[model samples]
Target: MWREPWPSSNRMPFTKKRKLQLSPEQCSDFYADQYGKFFFPSLTAFMSSGPIIALTLARNNAIAHWKSIIGPVNSTKARETHPECLRAKYGTSDLKNALHGSESFHAAEREIKFMFPNSVIEPFPSREGIEEYLSRYVNPTLLHGLTELCKHKPHNPCVWLADWLMKNSPNKPKICDGVTVEEAE
Candidate 1:
């Protein structure tokens, strides 16, 4: 009864037959546009696999946090361990990790564009909404990494540390004594 409705969904199985294939935009527009061909001809074929929920998580190190949250991309390894991870919990194979995130900000921008062209995918922290900032806040070091990423540069631990400080400084966040996989390790 726990895994209702979504069992055997395409998302549960990351197979060649189930992958979504989005095409690149073709060139030569103006009355009759003719250039690009469909990249994944069968993306439409798998429409009813399941309903996917899209989440926009706000954290100092959003991408990295998400990567960690989802854990590694492998599934068999996920099964034996990483049970707390999204992949470890539900991923049937190497592909279905139950979530997705932008590898980079540029990619995030492009992907947001592709998925929701007119939809507003705002940066963390609304300019005017004070309460929202608490929920959508980012720490300095994490922001720095995102800045470096925008410039196409590699990240440094110092930047990551800065983000860590930003995330924990204001709240003086509690350190859990409750057992967790990371804590057990």
Candidate 2:
């Protein structure tokens, strides 16, 4: 139901896309938690009838913008009031409306999790955190490794550097968390 300015133009980009055919049970589970028992039967039936496309759009104020473009929940009202809206052209009635959009950012996150269980959703690292992580975990060791590579000038530089980094990385896991190498063996 959400529409945005063209992704190619850099307004909003589609971050994820999935094509899925839901079973009745799956559809029931998806909608029942939010819409409640009254609407679940018809909604689930309709949703499970065919393949559906789920998309994740990313940008600021995305939920509000999408709601504006999709118009009201009632397709008839949408046709009468906002003829340009997606429901006006594609929907049949209130429950049979052709598209679904998350009502809020939190709902978006929840719905995305339901649809894509394996996908990780989290806030981006802060600038300070990123800088600290780079300084502590990457910069000094990477600089030293690069200097060594430059001095050695190995014929297979990529492989040599990979081996060096693997061997020298401070973050590399030991044989056991608290045990010494001999104890672990």
Candidate 3:
């Protein structure tokens, strides 16, 4: 996203320019300072990086749950991390802090449009979700948790996961009912 003080049609000032110059990491720090550290480089960077906010979340509690995960506007003002709060880690500055979850369902629809003008926030879309999720979840380890899940039960786990997926996931199934790990391999 591009952070210009004035509208694309209007002339702007230098402060917005400075805000724009922040590297993704510095931006992350800035937002982390606000408690956006655990959310979507911390959302503070992304917000400060641009003038508007947008999201095309799924129908399943995407807005409300995202808000819960985002935590309060003030990280210090909040109580628990909500256990799954996005701000528990990523937030930093209030001005540049991460995430502005839609206040209501209607707002989510409107905000999503403003944040995403094109068809959707798909791959190679206007904003960046891949980098966002990474900054939120990555640790020092080389392997993500999935590596252990893969190693522990390549055979049994797939079925377990497939069932869970069938029960809870919106994404389609990849592994067939009769397919074996060897076949997959």
Candidate 4:
């Protein structure tokens, strides 16, 4: 299923651009599993012929939305049906379609991995999960800190609260080996 990024947008939310020229062998390897044996060679040659821009688009239903904007695979068909589309406006034929979009979420993930090996794709957290995390780890500690701050009414409340939280935190590391200053009698 298509996974939308957190904080939904009406438009494309994120774009990462990579400019690279692929060798024919690299192109062949890239499309090996996607295209058939007969179609692979030409597709590889065309892809490797010049420099290409690889873009990663992130938003709600990005793949489907982009595909719609680019129009059909055949430029001639796109011209007839969707004259405003990128392929219709720029492409000359089916194989020479002006742009390519991932067919599905799986294809998108696969293509992204192939194109950007170093990149990390993270799944968005569910709303319930986020709420649960806050409730379990944050609310109690924050409540205590806020209550103490209100009671003490420190001159620099923000700093005071921060220091108080740090000092009172169960997660704070203990320094057992540190020298203690003895009180003067």
Candidate 5:
């Protein structure tokens, strides 16, 4: 299912440049130290060369699913191996792959924070915990359009939630007492 794109466009002036330049040390910290300095400049240049999409997804094992679906970093290899994958079908070359997926949960969180500074995503939850939290808080708010209500009463979670549900519940259709159904002959 296609979800909404990033709230801000890549071409927008506010996002015209990379938010943080990864120093050689930082790059080593984030991406393994085995990658030499020679690789960093070209990688940075390629990344900054055009607009890129950042996705904020919520689901079980999203990192693994996305990485598998996109095939591999090298489009050519992906085409030869996983022809049905997204990169195999759409990617131009190894450097210009059609999509990017985080290597791990930590990487996903960092990338999401980098792309959307204002957004706050809690640490990844276990499958059971995620389902419970979604059922209790997230899904209801979305279904009832309680964003504004929550914003207004940010300090009081229960108040806005209760108000939102009470105001938005659907009315039942009136039933006729004398109506009876007959079995088909």
Candidate 6:
């Protein structure tokens, strides 16, 4: 999972005391009329009270897996029904559930764009095919290669990373196929 800075517009949804500043129409639109009116204020407040960390994760059936791990939307109910789930273990109540999972693949794509506007996420090949998806779409970049060292190899990792970055840094000029600024005209 990778962390991203929260969007500034999220702050407009609630008050300092964590009360929602939304109209009934807005609440319906946001929640898709799934939750009751009474819950909307607290739900919005909870979501907007502070900066939220956005994460990108990959796995077979990722959406379903993540939803299952988070359990029910109501944390108290999750604790009684799914004691092993993340919300059941860490959440205090429905209003304070600690995680959010996308409910569908389309929703996940849209949400990813909303959180990280410049992200380059490809459409999924198949929800059940993890290996094929990874091989086809998830090529290891310089950053990913360096990060993998901690898991696959840990000997002198810091030195290895420093050396790798020095070799790859764009500050050192190299021959290129594209036109330079001087030749563009």
Summing lDDT over every window of 10 consecutive residues in candidate 5, give the lowest-scoring window: 1-10
Model 6 compared with the native: what TM-score? 0.50
Per-prediction tally of clashes: 2, 0, 23, 0, 0, 0
Residue pair clashes in candidate 5: none
The weakest ten consecutive residues by lDDT in model 3 span: 10-19
Q: For every model shown, what is its TM-score relative to the native structure?
A: 0.41, 0.60, 0.35, 0.64, 0.52, 0.50
Cα-based lDDT at residue 176, candidate 3: 60
Instruction: For residues 65-155, write the lDDT of model 4, one tens digit per residue.
Output: 8888779989999999999877787777777786788877888888888888888988767889989978876787899899999999999
In model 3, the Cα lDDT at residue 158 comes to: 64
Q: For candidate 5, lDDT tens digit of each residue in 149-185?
A: 6467667777767766665543323335865434232
* Best TM-score among the predictions, by candidate number: 4
Select the stronger candidate by lDDT from 1 and 2.
2
Clash count in backbone of candidate 1: 2
Worst-scoring 10-residue span by lDDT in model 4: 1-10
Kindly list the per-residue Cα lDDT of model 1 for residues 41-98, writing each as its tens digit.
2222222244444334455666787677667668678667677776777766554445
Look at candidate 6 and give me any clashing residue pairs.
none
- Candidate 1 at 82: error in angstroms? 1.9
Model 1 error, position 99 (Å):
1.9
Candidate 5 segments exceeding 4 Å error: 1-37, 124-185
Candidate with top lDDT is 2
